[model samples]
Target chain A: MASSDILLSVRDLRIAFHGVEAVRGVSFDVRPREVLALVGESGAGKSLTARALLGMAPRGATVNGEIRLDGSPDLAAARGRRISLVPQDALSALSPVHPVGDQLAAAVRSVHRVSRREARARAVAALDRVGIPDAARRARAHPHEYSGGMRQRAVIAMATLNEPDLVVADEPTTALDAERREQVLRVLSEQREAVGAALLLVTHDLDVVRDHADRVLVMYAGRTSELGPTHTVLGQPRAPYTAGLLASLPQDGPRRRRLPTLPGTPPAPGELPPGCAFAPRCPLATDHCRSEEPETRELDGRLVACHHPDRIPDDTATLFEEEQPA
Target chain B: MTHLLDVRDLVVHYGTVTAVDGVSLTLEPGETLALDGPSGCGKSTTALAVLQLRRPDAGEVRFEGVELTSLTERELRPLRPRMQPVFQDPYGSLNPRHRIRDAVAEPLKVQGRWTEADGPTRVAELLDRVGLAPSYGARRPHELSGGQCQRAGIARALASDPRLLVLDEPVSALDPSVRAGVLNLLADLQDDLGLGYLFICHDRAVVRHFADRVVEMRDGRLVT
Candidate 1:
């Protein structure tokens, strides 16, 4: 992770809607050909962070951040060209009426000035690269006509068509079935190298995060809770939010009476409590945690925003039992 | 108890395309049968056919040993009360205009399970059973989160006192952290109610954890 190898660097990024901070002081970097995952529950600002990278933040939002794309120092100028976005909801991400091929060609032409025929040809190649079979014929089909998985691939093809230096895919595998999820994840991992672009995969899929992502950034209530290599983070999460999330996942072992859930829902952006927003829900929260926000600190090899970054002992059952839903 | 739901050689066609081809599955009381597959693999069409939302081109759907395929809509009304569906998109499936209380009680009222007094009480009880607070009964679908709306959807379906619940990707719309809660709730509900479930989902991991029997579908047919 050399500085120069980083394709996109986000420092002290803050996004707010109507004076409500949705993403507050989040920071991370996406390195070339690396797959980095941003994981969190809804309202954790993962989507907003990804949106900010593409300069596609919703209307009436105040954003202040230093986002360096390919060392260019500004994402606004690089978005849709050096940087690309593969949005959630493939059906809606694509134009329902337009042929998938034409939409992809439009994306290609957006970055590079090319003839319609050349762009269409490139679009077909891109679709084929993503493993959409019968690319030429399928590209001719409308978004509605293509299957759910195909629609996702077509969208992905459009994102990576220009071989952008950075790609931010928001919930790419969501709303898809197991096989299709695997297919989409495979396409993303493959395309990261083939296109030589860094991937900022924003998803809640822990399975994918563990298997596909090189590094992981865990968010909680509009803040960076943990940022580390996937193995280190998922294997031994230092942040209570990350640990609680891992603890809550239903495993293949035995079925529990109820899931080990983090108490209370994520705070709404505007209504977020003072101090650490997650203090109310954190099992390890202290008096200090309730009175003051925890500053991001360097733990062994990662950044952890927690008063107690010491790894919780692996009592397993008791650790899960301690955090009963409030 | 005998099989609560039984499907035989079910086939659904969309013109020239065979959406669900010769698929057969059965559900025993208190058992969860997960139909796991990718998109466009006919898992949904099979669920729809089994629920009689759509007619099958071939094969039979029998509920409690009675043939559902040949029954007319009017004739199917009584039997319909024994089978209810919890759909995929809670935001889309739950009526935006109706409050949770009304939505849940509507099913009971349709089935004549309540008089005036029992309806509200029953709605409250159903809401409680689905882990929703009684206060939530007053809120509309739009006021609730995705998980809350899904819980309301489940509460509505449970209002019919159905022995079989056809849950179509019920937790897929929910956030991952919320998904476990819903799944645990569904599993708990099955234990308490002795409900049979046709859990149609694409997540194999979920099926492995939740389903007693899993039938994987690929391209309109079962792989195993």
Candidate 2:
């Protein structure tokens, strides 16, 4: 992570809706050509933090702290041609009434001054880039006419039409099946390689992040709980919450009847407890964890927020094996 | 163990389009059967048909030895409590304006088994069982997270104490990290209560993890 190569930098960012802090002082940096994943449970503010980068926070939400895009003061003031988003729900994001080709053409024309015919040609090329089999025929179809996977490809096509510097994908593979998920991820990877754009992928899928992301950030209760290399954060998590999450996944080898779950639910916005937000559910919580919030500390090159960070039992194999009954 | 719900040659047609065609399956007590397929493959239609929300053009739905296809909507009203569904989208499934307590108690009320005196306590216990706080009973759908909403949906589905629960992509809308938690919760609930589950999803990984048996569907028909 060279400072010169950094494309996006978020520092002490906080978001509040109706006086309730949804994202509490989170910070991370995205390099120019690497994929950084923000992984967390629902209500962890991963999506909110992504939206904050584009100044797309919900109405009436108050944002504090700094967000610098390519060293710019405000992301909203940055050229629209530079930053783009691929939203989660492709069906809802795309207009159902219009032809898919027209939507892509609009995106093309919005970023570049081109004739309608030229924009259509660029749209077709973009669709082709995303591996939609019949790019020309599919371009003429409406959003509803395309399959769910095809519609998602079209959304990606639209997101990359302008060859933006940064692509923010929020749960891009939520409803997609295993095959379609692979296809979509492959397309994103190709786009990153060809265009040299930074990717900020916000998802709940640990497998996707582990495979595709260069770095991983674990968010809990609207804050960054841990950040490190994908393998370290996943394989040997330092934070108790991250370890609990890893324990809960059903991996390849075996299966357990019940995964070891972190007790208690996600804290509601504006109601988070003092000290560590995860302290209530963390098994390693002590008096220090309950009274004082731990600051981000560098341990083995990864950033972790915990008073007593220790090694979690390497029960991955055992837990997974237990999940499988004879 | 007796089969709690059985579907044979079930077919659902929307005009000429066959959403679910000739699907057959049987779920035993305390078993979790996963129905998996790509989008538009008719897994949802089969579940809807079992609930009698979609009338099948052909086939029989047997619940505890009783055939449901021949029953009219009026006759099926009582049985509705015996078989309830938990949908994927909790926000859409739940009435946004209704409090969690009211939403969870609605099924019991519809079955004419709920009274005002015990409704609150039952709802509280249900919320707690689903990993939500008892105070969450006062919150609306919009006030909770996607996982919490799904938990509420599960709690509501369990309110009537049904023998079978049709989980239609129940955890699909959740985050990957949260999904494992919910799936574990479902497994715990099933083991504790000895409930039968018809879990419908498109994710193979989830199906392999949560189900005792997996049934694959394609174009409204079972492929395997």
Candidate 3:
């Protein structure tokens, strides 16, 4: 793809906390109005990677990389106007003191030179657009008064109120159950589409990635494990870690006594193994894998960071056994 | 044999609002019975009533052929240890100030089952059984990962040697990889100990995979 075709480009993004690198040399791009999912377990640096895009890395953290917005490289000036965030905690994104609608109107007035009445009307319409029933009345209520699902929707509305080119949502639906999760995700996707914004969605839910994301970037430890189209990557995974994660998922099928789990936990930052960060737990790890860190290489129409991508078994379900006595 | 747990006409009310209405269920030993539903649908309320943590407004909770609703506080004291609850938020469920070892040993010490000679050994055994390392017992709840903290919570529940475990969204708060490990541990524990599980979960995939039978709840009533 051409450089101009990308909405946002990140090159060798590195985030470090007190000299210990957590997100090490990760790189990817957000295409124009596309949903790119950043997926991994806790401590995998997916959240930090997303935060770095908005120049919102944690206090005292050192971030070094190239984050360019349409070849401009000025994220701070373009944060709310061109790239907005829908954080995991909806309450934190909203003010408990102000009515939800007023907060959204304030967000609008900050970016655009609009009258208060016009902004308030736009706020209520935005709320209504996200399926918040009685948007006018509910907009007058504080965020604490809104139900959990409604509070989440209000945040979604607030994020897209400015109609940014990119929306970075970090685990927006993690706290919700099945029904509420679907509702919130639908509203988020719909609002993003209505605003014509690409999404940098950071979540641990593979089902959400499969259903919503156009492309997926699977991170392990702090590096890219795989990056490809959602169906191709999830259906025929080229990375061992990705396959192990998929195999562990409980599907709607005949129940099994045990799930195929990765043997060890993800290594803590600054404590990674000699070669691959996932080598200790990877079933396909060989001596070569243990000695040399594999760079991101193109294979099977996707990017996989593994020396033996083709050696991944056809049936990844049997990759790792629990090794228990019956 | 009597059913391990039998709840009949269970009703819980928060002031004027009825949370769980006329819910009935039965679980046999070594079986997992899931109460599946959306949020605010009274799944946790029913579990609390079964555990007698929240006395139902009206119901009959018969555990091991004994009607618990008729029991007084003193009468219910002994039965409390037999039915334990594993909550959703692993860190919130455990004390932040207490060491993981102390948390696990609390139930043993409370029930007058602890001895100076074997208490520490028993704590070590419980931690090992739940896939936690011995060194982890020295740390507080915040120091451990979510999955490890949940295992610590499970070890604490197992310290009571309960006949029934009221697992309320035990794995939902965990990551998928970690959730699978916890679920596997629960399955192994139930099989080896012949314990019954009153599993309350909102994830349908997890309910279908983990439970022997599932009852769907909506508006405080069973849909099926």
Q: What is the interface RMSD of candidate 1, in Å?
A: 2.1
In angstroms, the error of model 1 at B104 is 1.4
Top-lDDT candidate index: 3
Q: Residue B110 lDDT in model 3? A: 95
Task: Judging by TM-score against the true structure, name the best candidate.
Answer: 3
Q: List-wise, what DockQ does each model earn? A: 0.51, 0.48, 0.76
Q: What are the per-residue Cα lDDT tens digits for candidate 2 across A13-118? A: 9999888899999999898888999988878999999988877889999999898887877676454567788888999999999999999999888878999999
Q: In terms of DockQ, which candidate is strongest? A: 3
Interface RMSD of each: 2.1, 2.1, 1.1
Cand. 1 Cα-lDDT: 0.86
The whole-model lDDT of each prediction reads 0.86, 0.85, 0.92
Off by over 4 Å in 2: A74-79, A316-326, B116-125, B128-132
What's the ranking of the predictions by lDDT, best on top?
Answer: 3, 1, 2
Candidate 2 per-residue C-alpha lDDT over B134-187 given as tens digits, one digit per residue, 9 for 90 to 100: 888999999887888999999998898988999999988876556777898898
Model 3 agreement with the true structure over B141-169: per-residue lDDT tens digits: 99888999999999999999999999999
Alpha-carbon deviation at B202 in model 2, angstroms = 2.8
lDDT of 1 by residue, A59-138 (tens): 99899889887667755668888888888899998888889999999888877888999999999999999988999999
Q: Give me the runs in candidate 1 sitting further than 4 Å from their true place.
A: A1-3, A70-72, A254-259, A315-318, A322-326
